[model samples]
Target chain A: MKIEDKKRVLREMVLHRRFEERCYQAYIERKIGGFLHLYPGQEACCNGVMEAARPGHDYVITGYRDHVHAIKCGADPKEVMAELYGKETGSSKGRGGSMHIFDVAHRFMGGYALVGGPFPLAAGMAKAIQLKGGDEIAICFLGDAANNQGTFHETMNMAALWKLPVLFVCENNLYGIGTAIDRSTAVVHQHKRVAAYNIPADECDGQDIEVVYEHARKAVDHVRSGKGPYFLELLTYRYRGHSMSDSRGYRSREEEEMWKQRDPIFILRDRLIAAGEMTMADYEALEKETDAYIENEVIRFAEESPEPRVEDLEKYVLAERETQLPWLTGKAA
Target chain B: MAQIMYWEAIQRAHDEEMARDPLVICMGEDIGVAGGTYKATKGLYEKYGPLRVMDTPISENGFTGLAVGASFLGVRPIVEIMSVNFAWLAMDQMFNSAAKVRYMSGGQLAAPCVFRSAGGAAHQLGAQHSARMEKVFMGIAGLRVVTPSNPKQAYGLLKSAVRCDDPVFINEHELMYNMKGEVPDGEYFHPLEGSEIARSGTDVTLFGYNISVHWCLKAAEILDKQYGISAEVVDLYSLSPLDRDGIRKSVSKTHRAVIAEEDEAPVGVGSEVIAIINEECFFELDAAPVRVHSALVPQPYNHTLEKAAIPDHEDVVKAVLKMFGKA
Candidate 1:
């Protein structure tokens, strides 16, 4: 990667880290409600892959640990936070909370609550792109645990058979809630599971941003080139528990500490510093700037955003035919 | 107007819709090469080719979700579940993803697709194959459930379902595939809401849908010829967003009602119809609304036992006669 691209990637990973850290505090403070799944430790996995995606042409869909994915895909931070706060100014107009953030204009399809929901959806979007005569591809991000779902095998078979232009990404965080990957799934290597369908797959160290970018670029090229769906497994870990209320008694503190030492954000920052591109002062400045932005801009905007009224609760239950405002609105910020 | 078989009428709607819009596609098991088990998708694969008329793997959950997903981008996918019994495997996709994606996404997305499946009992298929699951779909919020009685409705309602901006489940009777009727010519679209009075009379009203509509029509003939009872029959085409006012109009005129359904008694269409009558036309009714539904047990495999389980024309007559204290 170029020096300029490296700096941008490092900054985005740091910003995502800072944003998720504050969200953790906000959830504790009872400001952000509902099921909160943080993506603090998996920034490189999203930023690396999403940066390679075509901004308006390519589509992105993921599981619910999705704050960074939406932000990385160009959704406004203010609107995203507002959605988590259940505010009217949110992306989904306060109708979809944390688990469902969607912006069609940006082509960030959604953050599905169900574990394996996005597989078939990604295939569908790819079909639409194929029928429309576009090389635009769909990237569906799922967890290692979701690999056990019947949707995984089913979608992979259809995607391979139909040769849908989709990149099936598995963010292997080693654990599905409390159950470990080896305990839940018979196949530990998720990419190999897709071999039954004859789809090409690759695995990478998600803790390293450069490695993630390199592997993701190759996979994206394969799908965009209409070589069928490519499954890429990004082996990473989460710093926090699965949700806001998780005790995380299943995993040890040592295992958590082990993953945190090689955090993606730290890896990118150290690489830039060692390359004499950025100093310790520059790194501190970036962290301070990101923290200030989250506190003053993102959180302030969400706190100030208005809560949707009860009277309009039924507004988006079905799309309106005339304007299609809220549902089929082509312009999504 | 061409008189065609019920399945042929459905096939014509599929053919016409596929011709009308390039976005319209069909996906199911054996639908492409084998011409569908029920022949509802006959000649479509040859007409539209493989890309448009897709033959999916036996994985109902996967293909159903894929079709629902395709609809998000404005691709009108008409997914056919070979049997409604097989649809049980896809209900998670049907209920959670397809039905609720629009509302759950706060209308930022909509699944404008049709899930066409042939349900209702067909001789000794046993409890598993013979499932009348329209009641299962009717209870769901975002779905439009429609059951067709004859050829015209099977054609018109299906065309309308494809065009509608909501997910629709067209529950066709497996036994009624050979039944023939006249389908009107040139651009016909039936509304996905409201009930049609199949026959008009004054003494009593007989309510039915799908196969049960034929039973009510037959029972009406028997009631008029044998007992001198003027019986009106209402075909409940749209099961959900039910025609409450249309039902009220018929029940108020007749002052009596008999709801005939192939499904069991509890929490079925019959219950909902009776509830509507009690709420809307209580004062107009001369006698309590009677429901002529199948036995509450699973459909038996034996021919004699199976015939006794399902409600026929005689059951409708017996219920009506009992209401009049003449049984």
Candidate 2:
């Protein structure tokens, strides 16, 4: 990877990490409500894959551990935070909370809440792109557990058979809720599972942003070249519990500490400092700046953003209910 | 104009829509080469080819989600389930994703998708297949539920559903598919979310939809000929955006009402109709509205038992007579 690209990936990943960490604090303080799925430990997977694709051209869809992906995909932080705060000025006008962040203009279809649901959607989006004579690819981000889902096979078959432009990136964090990948599936190597569909597959170190970005770029290039769908299994771990309410009795404290030792953000920061590209003071200054940025967004999201009006609930249900049709003249008996 | 069966009209609508628009496509099990279990999508694959007409594995949830996503990206997808019984597999996508996408997205997205399935009792198909679950969909906010009784209405409503920017649930009666009716040639669009008064009268009002509409019409004809009672019949083609005003208008003139439904009596479409009438036209009604519906029991597998379970022409006439105190 180029030096500039590496630096940019590191910066974005750091920003995402700090943003989520601060979100956790705000969540506890009762500022940001609803289900908050922290993506702190999985920052590399998001930044790495996002950096590989061309924004505003290629589409990205993922599961609910999504704030990082939204930020990395170029959604304004303030608007995303505002959405988390359930403000009318939010991205989905506060109708969609943390789980359903969508920006059509930016090509981020959404962060769907249902597990394994986004796979088929990504396949369909790829089909649409192919039908429209576009080379743009769709990157589907899912967890390790999603690989065992029936939709995974169904969508992979469709994508391969149709040769749709889609890259399936599974962030293998080992555990889905409480069930570890080994206990959940017979085949632990999720990348090899795509082999049944005859799609080429690869694996990457999701903890290393540069490694993930390089592999993602190659896989995306293959899909864009009309080589059909490709699967990339990113080996990673999450430092936090699955959700705010999870006690995480399934995994040990030692296991969590071990994963934290290889934290993507800290590792990347150390790499930059060791290479003399960035100093300790420079890293401190960057963290302070990100903290200020998050603080301002929280204040704006809480104070200035309006709650959605009660009447607005009924507005978007139907496209045009008022346009009368000729055959609608009374009831038939 | 041409006379065709209701199922044939549905197939024609899908064929015409696929031919007219490149984005319009069909996806479902047995819909490709088998041409749908009931032949509703017959000859679609031959004309549109495999790319437009897709044969999916029996993963209703997956394909339904695929259709929803495709709709979000500007494709008008017509998803067929072999039977409405199988639709329960995809209801999560239907209720959560497809129906709620437009509202949840706050108008940023619209799910212009149609889910068509054969519903209601047909012979001895048994309890599993004999579900008049259109009422369940009617309760959902964003979905437009339509049940067309004849070929003309089927074609027009289906064409409108394919073109509409909302998720439409079209319930077709398996038994009524072969019944022929007149359908106009060339481009035509029927209005969804509206009702149609099939037979106009002055004495009493009869409300029915889908298969029951035919029975109600037959009953009205019988009452007009055998007795002096001229009963008006109203077909609630669309259930969600129900034409309450139209029902009220008919009830005001007739002063008496009878609601006929193919489903079980309690909490059925009849209950909703009765509630609406009581709320809207209480003063206009001469007697409390009568509900003629299927018995509250699992649909029996025996042909005779099944026939007795669902409402028929005789049942409709009996209900009207009872309402008039002439039984």
* Model 1 C-alpha lDDT per residue in residues A1-333, reported as the tens digit of each score: 788999998888888888888888888888888999999788888888877777666888888888888887888988888898888888887877888888777888888888898889889888888787787898998899988888999999999999999999899999999899888888899889999999999999998888998999999999998899999999999988899889999999999999999999888888889999999999999999999998899999999989889998767655454543222221212
lDDT tens per residue, model 2, B188-245: 7777866788999999999999988988899999999998899999999888778888
lDDT tens per residue, model 2, A24-69: 8778988778888888788888778777888767888888888777
Off by over 4 Å in 1: A321-333
**What is the iRMS for every candidate structure?**
6.7, 3.4
Give the distance in Å from residue A40's predicted Cα in candidate 2 to where it truly belongs. 0.4
TM-scores vs. true structure, each candidate: 0.96, 0.95
* Residue B316 lDDT, candidate 1, scale 0-100: 95
What TM-score does chain A reach in every model?
0.95, 0.94
- Tens-place lDDT per residue, model 1, B1-327, is 988899999999999999999999999999999999999999999999988899999999999989988888889999999999999989888888888777666668889889999898898999999988888999998888898899998998888888778888999988999998999887677767788999999999999999999899999999899999999999999998788998999999999999999999899999999999999989999999999988988889999999999989999999999988889
Taken over the whole model, the C-alpha lDDT of each candidate is 0.88, 0.85
DockQ of all predictions against the true structure, Cα-based? 0.42, 0.50
Give per-candidate clash totals.
1, 12
Docking class of 1: acceptable
Query: Best-fitting candidate, measured by TM-score?
Result: 1
Q: Name the best candidate (by lDDT).
A: 1
